[model samples]
Target chain A: MESGQHMLRTGRRGTLFEFSMALRDLVTSYHRRGLAWSLAWHDVVSRYRGSILGPFWITISMGLMVLGIGLLYAKLFGISVAEFMPYVAMGIVFFGLMAGTINEGCDTFVQASSMLSQTSLPMFTFIWRTVLRNLINLAHHAVIIVAVIIFFGLWRVMDVLPALGGLLLTIVNLAWIAMLAAIASARFRDIPQFVMSVMQFAIFMTPVFWKPDAFPDRHAFLTLNPFYHMLTTIRAPLLGQEADGLSYIILAIMAVLGWALTFSVFAITRRRIVHFL
Target chain B: MTDVSIKVTDLTLRFPVYGVDAKSLKKNLARVTVGGRLGASTTGATEVTALSHLNLNLRAGDRLGLIGHNGSGKTTLLRALSGAYEPDEGQIEVRGRIAALLDLSLGIDPSATGVDNIRLRGRIAGMSSKEIEDKMDEIAEFSGLGPFLAMPMKTYSAGMQARLAFAVATAVEADVLLMDEWISVGDADFQKLAHRRLLNLVERAGILVLSSHDAGLLRLYCNKVMRLEGGVASEVKDIRRLDELLAAA
Candidate 1:
């Protein structure tokens, strides 16, 4: 409930005031994170409501994908299944989370258009909803990661901490990207299609299937791909190897720079987003 | 909780009507090379002035009615007052918890049960879990959905859906309640219940801003009335003079 003063003024705001207001909105939405979690859970449950397997079906399909692609690519590359199964399984899972979050982020505002137009609900609520819902899907797909890692007998219990940290960092990075995509796509309807195509092309280019070790000479190009760094933050840690310092450095820089850019755009356009929708 | 107020100074809101051309990147990219004469008509988003330089103030115990012809900014003014739209020129300052019944069906999810939707709406209204739980039965009772509350909302008729939404919306006991129109939902019996419930909600409210076409309804609830003509508002006149104002219009 709004217990204090609420003010809305026209035209440009002082940078400090605008950013402070935007930061306040983020904080307010954070307090309402429970609502977002519930909505995201509802989104997942309701989508698969009457089905027997329900959301588990997503895991099943993802399981099939990792197995199919992991085995096929392992044979094609002449690598042992043990060497490749865990890598591809995790790549698909983590990449799915990243792309799905960014893709669905295109709908952040558009999906909440009804509530946004009629109520004073914080705009960030829907962005978190989109991110959380995709995160839930990632959870379903995580079963594949667990089964693959255990089948290959690949991880130490201590390795779980770093992998969890990597997962958290990856989610933080995707959150800003999703917010930006949602903001842009709310006004430009074609942005979603464009995003979908870009992500599709990105899957092949980001080494989700092929390992970077397979082409050691081209390692410099991998560093240039932000998705590769994001993937490494999670995949490398889970495989019991240290992510290159550059990958974590690049990820930290991306998180900081991406959030800064997203916040600026969001602060300036927060109010006008309704009109765009 | 008692000192509720709303003040708008020279508030103006313009809606940018985005055409398909303006929304499409493909067409815009195509027009970069062929973009000279088309600039004025093709990709430019047409702006419609929804509310222009409107000013209003209401304090505790004030119930103001908004009357206007269709597309004369009635809904737009309510939306701006609700903080759903930003003022394009002026400022809107409000003190109180606001419950805007601008769109009854705005948050209803058909796939969810009626009971679940009440929770969803409650969450949207910024209610905590305990508060929503406490109000759930009361809202369900007021909606008169009874056993149907457990069933998915999709099975309910449009009127039934409206009933659930209205019940949950009005349950908030808002300090400032902004309503688009008098809700007429369900059978004659439910309408009576809804009207009584709304009257009670408005009675407890510190300030009420209702926009409606029904003069009778306005006279019953509002102490003052204002007419909007093409995004411009007339003076806030006393409710007793509504007939004279209507006749003059």
Candidate 2:
């Protein structure tokens, strides 16, 4: 018979234990990758179930926006449409990916409250599902990228390797951001709205439509923006331009720091998360 | 086979009630700007102790029935046992595959069809894809919603939805089963079928914890009865003598 002599107290020690338990749960859930993958696929398929176009709707809209904005904005910025079209196309596609992840991440845990309360599955499973779903959306939007590259004759076989590498790095960074946003939004409840507003503001601020040369004097300030680095790392390679070493360094550092901060907070509050829900 | 057991020692759970305005960032920011004392007075941050210093133990073959009034913490205790709520105080060690039926529609997505929901619910219950696939035909047959299974779940009636949920929940065999109440829905014939299925599932489980207000039902199914009042638990030794026990308490 197991003894119940050891009492479980709700304090700092308990939080530390819960943190370790949460990490274990995360690892175990990863081993059960089928759960996350299927759930993510289910979410995407169900959301657009009855529609004829389904998720291709995203591809169509992105294509139209690229055609319209690429033409109008290229002339406005006095750049050749041939050169500017790919830039804006890649910019919008990648920005949609980044901003969509952040926006959806905020509701990750909150939205799964029903399933979370009923089962003993790991909390990280929901986070992974959110990331996977957004990745699926990104895949749908990538068709537009393919079309733009073909239209603009910007496809380079050699650049494909680096672009994929950059995309993998970006996905790694997104996982941590999603985890952080999900946990925070679950606790605060007001965080999803706050995050959505911030993302809306970030799009204009991050040069998704405008070129960096437009503000030659403020180039230094634009470089400091992490979102700019995030966009450039993947966008540059897809446009057949070399991604600067500085952007890679900045993004790698952000990934490490972001995971560290997210892990610490998640460890302390994993147990209390259910209470908030 | 692993021996199934549950041990809960001095388990306490508290829920913090955040009022409507308290959940808003704008309101909280404004409160912080105003002096701490004034903000504290207006803020409604109170804790409701759902379970208080509750201890329980159950070994294999122990069928424990829980009786409690509204707000008496029966559901809270069930949730804690299912690993849904981490206790604020005390320890809970459960050794078994636990199947918790706290709510019928817990994992059923309204947008999905009945067949799809079975897969989703099975996955949520921690079954591997192979297992879900193996059991799909049986679950479909048990639900008896044959043609309706093709339509979205939102199109199903309440009783039909309940039947699907019950079928999916009881499809897998678990060592420890925690159920909030006896589920009886659908028509007379279907209810009888569901009741028989539930009884078979309860018998096959190593341990069962059920919460319900029907004393007669408890007397029939449970060998041990526990009554919860204000987060405290006490055993009722004899079902026949429950009235005397209640009066004494």
Candidate 3:
């Protein structure tokens, strides 16, 4: 607690040096084990208290959505049932994880305004809870992703390793998004709405329903869209193809930049947080 | 002064409220349309001081009552003492944790069961889950909301809700207990239990600062009284002076 106070006081000076040190301390303190898991479990059980097969409903709905969309999009795109089915199914799973993470990410602190405003604890707990809930949702939906891939004969020796990589990258991406959005949304209050509008445009701009190769001339724009790269990183690798190092580097840079910005903002504005709340 | 366990020196806190600065609608419109300054040579926006150069000291076993009109900085001082708000211009040093009953209703979650909310509030009070579990039966009995303990907190009546919050909050053994007003837990049998519980809790706390306008109650319970007016503490030079002032009035 003394160290926590020191970090806060030094943070108030707003020096870049103090800011980075505080950020390091913040990340290190987040590793205090089991706190996040307990809170997240609390969030899950309390959210669906009365319902039977509560979280299983997540899996059932997702499976039905993929099945319905896979058949419809396969016919609409005039592609073979065999090839198109895998693509659409994988796309829905991958896109769901990406969009759900960012959408929920922006509201992480705002939604937890109730908890944070009352008790003075580590801010990471709120962010971690958001990340954990999404991860839980992913786990439920992953059953669908797995069932579809196995049914379509997409599972292979190399597929296992790439699937792990995809999961890891997705987690890392969501973590970064949560940290960034919490700080931004806490400050602006309008950033969540702005993010929602931007996501609407990003849905069409990214190659979710369509293939990346659909835009032959606008290759640069496709590459610039981080989601395009994230999807490619996860989906391509799972399909037993080479993952893009360029996209990985791009995402790595974005993650670092995002954290840096969040750290500075959080350090500068932490005391003001209660006032806003 | 020798027994002083908490000290506040020249404390000042300024809040910058964000919005148009004008005090009136007509003035705001004039400033917006004509680009005219509302005040003589400066913009209408300025700092509204919530606390200004206030100084006080308190000792262990002191029960102090604060009395003030609305906007008189009673809540701000409480917030500052509890470390909720940082003072801009001076120092406040208290030896132990300050438990403030500023807003009882805000800490509770409507969606959670009474039992669950009790656990959550326990955690907020720095009690580990294991500690809360150990006291679970005691807290349940204290709340007096039998069978409905398993129901959502929103289902409880206002009095029942206050019982749950008060039960959980008092479960913590605090160093200093700050109360804004007297919280009455309103059933006859439970009210007696609550009174005994509150008296015991207040006795255990080393320092108690209560803010209320009821002078007779303050004289009965508090050892000292401090008057605040226009964001400043009234200058009572000594205990004799304070008593003289209170007696003369």
State the displacement of the C-alpha of residue B131, model 2, in Å, after optimal TM-score superposition. 1.1
Better of 1 and 3 by TM-score: 1
B218 Cα displacement, candidate 2 (Å) = 1.9
TM-score of candidate 3 chain B vs. the reference: 0.79
User: How do the residues A161-248 of candidate 3 rate in per-residue lDDT, one tens digit apiece?
Assistant: 6556656766777777767877666655666787788877887788767666567743798778878777777777666666677777
By lDDT, the better pick of 1 and 3 is 1
When summed lDDT is taken over every stretch of 10 residues in candidate 3 chain A, the lowest stretch is A2-11
DockQ of 1: 0.66
Best model number under lDDT: 1
Q: What is the TM-score of chain B alone in each candidate?
A: 0.92, 0.90, 0.79
Worst 10 residues of 2 chain B by lDDT: B35-44
Quote the lDDT for B97 in model 3: 54
lDDT of 3 by residue, B57-82 (tens): 87777777887787888887777776
Model 2 residue runs over 4 Å out of place are A1-15, A215-218, B39-44, B236-249
Docking class of predicted structure 1? medium
* TM-score of chain B as predicted in candidate 2: 0.90
**Candidate 3 pairs with clashing backbones:** none
lDDT of 1 at B206: 68
**Ten consecutive residues with minimal summed lDDT in candidate 3 chain B?**
B18-27
